[model samples]
Target: MKLSEGVEAAIHCAALLAGLAPGKTLPAAALADYHGVSASYLVKHLNRLVAAGMLASVPGPHGGYRLGRPATRISLLDIVLAVEGPEPAFRCGEIRQRGPGALEPEAYRKPCGINVAMLRAEQAWRGALRAARLADVIAGYEAEADPRALAFGCAFLERHQRPGSPLSNPE
Candidate 1:
């Protein structure tokens, strides 16, 4: 099923935050720059994450964002829900109730077969996402990513990650 771009951004942001040193955070603009997205567009999704307790926001200069909880405790499903919401991907319109042979409400007492099947599929999909922890995503990337690409990300983090202490933040 197709999910919104916000899901991708939220997941990526969480993954990137997974790499942050404790007491460090990344500004929304810096995150947008890393992913080649508009800062404004990315902030809304980031705000959703913050609201969901998946990401924590720190205000003021030298304040940005970091994971609200450990990567090990945050699932891909958490990020997906934070951005895409809890609605099922396939919302059955119950077209079976609309056709020529449509039966009375009492006659069609059972759940629609198509709706049941779609609901089962959605449950499976959500279960899979729930099984995927953000820490595991980081481990997989670190283990399998190209060294050159990894180096670029490492360098970018070094450049943009803001330390929590004002003394550590560059003017």
Candidate 2:
């Protein structure tokens, strides 16, 4: 199924936060700039992550955003649900009983093959996404990113991170 842009943004933003020093944070604008997303729109997704316990917002002069927990604990499904919500992407309307050639109870009481197939596909999709986590994505990225650049990026965030920022209760 096609996912929204927020899903990509939220995942990337979370991965970026994962690379930061523990307790360090980055402003929404910085995240937006890094991913070339609208700041306000990114904030909306960021808020979802915070509300979902995937990230946290620290308020104050040095206030910004940081991951609420380790990347390994955050799944892609968590980010997907946080932004797009957990509703099934496909909704069955029972159209079999509504068409001009509608079938009788015996034929209609049972689900159509198409519907059953779709449901199974949906279940499989959910299972795959559920098994995928932010840590998995980061591992792939880490494999490709230059170690020195990654180190520099982490150092930059730590050096520039604001002090006394509120820490998120990630439980």
Best by TM-score: 1
State the lDDT of candidate 2 residue by residue for 1-171, as single tens digits: 789999999999998888765555788888887788999999999999999989988887777888888888998888998999988877788787787898776777667777788889978888888899888998897889899977876766666566535445343
Query: Per-residue lDDT for 1-171 in model 1, tens only?
Result: 899998998999889977778788899999999999999999999999999988888887878988888898899999999898899999988778888998887887889898899999999999999999999999999999999989999889989998864333211
lDDT of 1 at 166: 34
Q: Output the lDDT of residue 71, model 2.
A: 83
Clashing pairs in 2: none
At residue 39, candidate 1 shows an lDDT of: 96
Q: Candidate 2 lDDT (Cα, whole model)? A: 0.83
Candidate 2: regions farther than 4 A off: 104-107, 146-160, 164-171
Model 1, global lDDT: 0.88
TM-score of each: 0.93, 0.86
Give the CA lDDT, 0 to 100, for residue 102 in model 1. 88
